[model samples]
Target: MDITAVNALPYEDFVNIFGNVVEKCPIITAAVWSRRPFVSLNALEAAISEFIDDLPESGKEGILRCHPDLAGRDLHSGTLTRESREEQARAGMDALSSGEASRMSRLNEEYKTRFGFPFVICARMNDKANILRQLTERCGNERAVERERGIEEVKKICRLRLQGLVLCDAPNKL
Candidate 1:
């Protein structure tokens, strides 16, 4: 949709269009809606980023918790959103060998146990092996540090999703 159409969309329509950008966090899209008439896709992104930056730690953790583990059960169980499934597949997550899958599952569990939240990365930006390596490395980070890193990863995922939703150069003329 064009930027003008985006700016004019009703709240429900806006949520339907962009809610999946942040997993199931419709609140993020809703908050961005309140700051509408985005001059460009960059403005829309800035609104979303500001909202995320201002969110309480609990809210940030809740958003992080909404994402599924990479190459994990959600992929096989059909629990992930279509966007997530496609992104994971693009990152070679769906083609992991049995051994690789098992290793990822273990690391996911370990990472969760250590950080109190699932490990998150912009899967579209990295292959499965690199994801696993980061998971292993991040598991050793201090809890607060890991939580902040997870939030940053979520921001990256959201930015990519928004790029898919918004026209990159269109001005909002509404």
Candidate 2:
């Protein structure tokens, strides 16, 4: 979509297009709709990042919690959002072997128990191997560090999703 068209979208249409850009957080899209006449796609994305950054710890954690676990039950049950389904497919999450899926499931549960939120990475940016590796490695992190890392990953996912929906000279992809 063109930035001009994006700026012209009614709030509902805008949300319809962008709502799940940050997984299940339509509130974020609703709030940012007021920041319209976005000068560039970058400014639009900045608004999203800024919104996420401004949240208190609990709110930030809430955003993370809304995300489905990579390769978890949502994917198995075909309950994932289209954006999530595509992102997971990009990371080859849809094709994990039974053994690999088993390991990922175990590590994901352990990480959530430790961190109080599911482990999140920009699946579009990393394949299954790296995702598994990071899940294993990041499971060792303290809560604060892991929380921030997950938020940053959320931003990366947001950027990519925005690029897909809004036409612009997207800045270098992360």
Candidate 3:
């Protein structure tokens, strides 16, 4: 939406337009359109970056929930964007070996049991084997460490996604 149009929107409407991500991730959603207009895309990005930077460690999990579980073959909801799906398909993970498939299932169960959530990664650029390998290793980390690592990884992925969608002039960094 244009800045003028965005500025005119009510607070509730503004939050709704952003897909309710603000409730769960205030850092990424801190930009209030009514108070100020971002002069350029970079300005908008800078606002988002500042918010993400200021978020407390405890708030990271809430933000992570805003991302979809990577290669979540059975997922029917959440932010599994079409572009992410296509990228996984290209990386040859839309199909899985029987062993790899079984491993993913088991890992999913173990991961959920430990974390109370499915393992989430931005699997845009990783191939099947590499993704599986990483998942296997991550499954063994202590809960606190894994949680921190997961948030950092998700932030990296989000930056890459924004680079692709919002920052056309810049190269994708992740």
Candidate 4:
């Protein structure tokens, strides 16, 4: 839909439209719905970011934990959202050889064990090898640092999803 159409959607409709942008974090989209009539994709993204920034540590952790492991259980069980499935497939995750899939599964477990949440990344922005490399390297990061990085990656994913759903435009003059 275009920016104007997006701006005109009702509260629940708006929230539903964007609810999956950050995986299972519908609360973030619900919060953003109150700041409606977004004139540009950036405005919508900023509102979402502000809501996330204001969340308590527990709330942030809940959002992080909502994300699925890369090429993990959801993919095999066909439980991933259509957007997520497409994004992972684009990253060559769907075509992983047995060895690659096994390694990814191992890294996913290690990363989650270390960070207490799934390792989040903008899959559409990286190929499988690059994602695996980063996953391996990031597994060594401090928990706080990894948490922040995951949030940033979530933002990038949200931005790309929003761009797919809304057209960019200059802010409306009051």
**Top candidate, metric TM-score:** 2
- Which segments of model 4 are wrong by more than 4 Å? 168-174
- Superposed model 1: Cα runs more than 4 Å off: 168-174
lDDT of each: 0.86, 0.92, 0.59, 0.86
Could you give candidate 2's per-residue lDDT for residues 1-174 as a string of tens digits? 667878999999999989988999999999999999898888989999999999999999999999999999999999999999999998999999999999999999999999999999999999889999999999999999998999999999998898887644444431
Clashes of 4: 0
Q: Show pairs that collide, candidate 4.
A: none
**Candidate 1 to truth, TM:** 0.93
**TM-scores for every candidate against the unseen true structure:** 0.93, 0.94, 0.65, 0.92
Clash pairs (backbone) in predicted model 2: none
Task: Give the alpha carbon lDDT tens digit for every residue of 85-109 in model 4.
Answer: 9999999988899999999999999
Segments of candidate 3 deviating more than 4 angstroms: 1-46, 73-79, 167-174
Per residue, candidate 1 scores C-alpha lDDT tens digits across 78-133 of 89898899999999999999899899999999998877789999998998779989
Model 3 worst lDDT window (10 residues): 18-27
- Model 4 TM-score on a 0 to 1 scale: 0.92
Q: State which candidate, 2 or 4, has the greater lDDT.
A: 2
Rank ordering of all candidates by TM-score, starting from the highest: 2, 1, 4, 3
Q: What lDDT is obtained when candidate 1 is compared to the true structure?
A: 0.86
Model 3 lDDT per residue over 1-174, tens place: 444554466766655554233224533543544335666545555566566667786566666655555546533343445555655567665677777767877887788788755576656657777877888888888877877777666655555644554434444421
